[model samples]
Target: MDQEDPGFSAVGEVAGDRVTVRVSGEVDMATADAMFRAATPGRVRAATLDLRAVTFFDSAAIHTLVRLADHYPGALKVFPSDRVRRVLDISGLGHQPWVSADQG
Candidate 1:
């Protein structure tokens, strides 16, 4: 979202009724807000946050994902990188309702 920080980058594109967000770089306290905002643009029937490019993830990012899951239910989904997946697993949030390796 903010180009000021080179450590984080996120982009979103609408596809039909769903939005697909591609997020890369660190997601820490400094970048979580930008990541969240990029992942969720507004109300939508379905959405997907693809974190395959993310290199770092932290507690703030985890909390943001949890909140997104709670707010969007089945409409919200996430595809995380191996590093991010480990963080989710360690945090016990990987198997949550909105996180999955495959949306189908």
Candidate 2:
């Protein structure tokens, strides 16, 4: 989904100390900023980003996640798929502690 396509969107929820971000369709540069802010739920000891619904990801998405992790330090837990994981790995964002959604 592209910017002009207008079918992409991001939704989020938080349970306890973990935040769950569920994204649908493409998450490109244009949509990253809003998604990042939407996913972020202020100061939490742990964050569980649920990416099971994200159909696409790009550097912007990866960078956004990294920035959040950097901001919070050792308090970011990401749940991403293979495509999303590739972005995180390439961007060195996967080094952060990752906790399974079910674990929380």
Q: Name the Cα RMSD for model 1.
A: 2.8
Off by over 4 Å in 2: 1-5, 42-45, 99-104
In model 1, residue pairs whose N, Cα or C atoms come closer than 3 Å (at least 3 residues apart or on different chains), thus clashing, are none
Tens-digit lDDT string for candidate 1 (1-104): 44335857878898777888888889888888887777677656677889988899989888888877776777888888999989999998888767776623
The CA lDDT of each predicted structure is 0.81, 0.68
Clashing pairs in 2: none
What are the per-residue Cα lDDT tens digits for candidate 2 across 1-104?
A: 54522666666677787666766667778888777776676855555566766778888877787777776577766677667766667777656575233323
Error of 2 at 72 (Å): 2.5
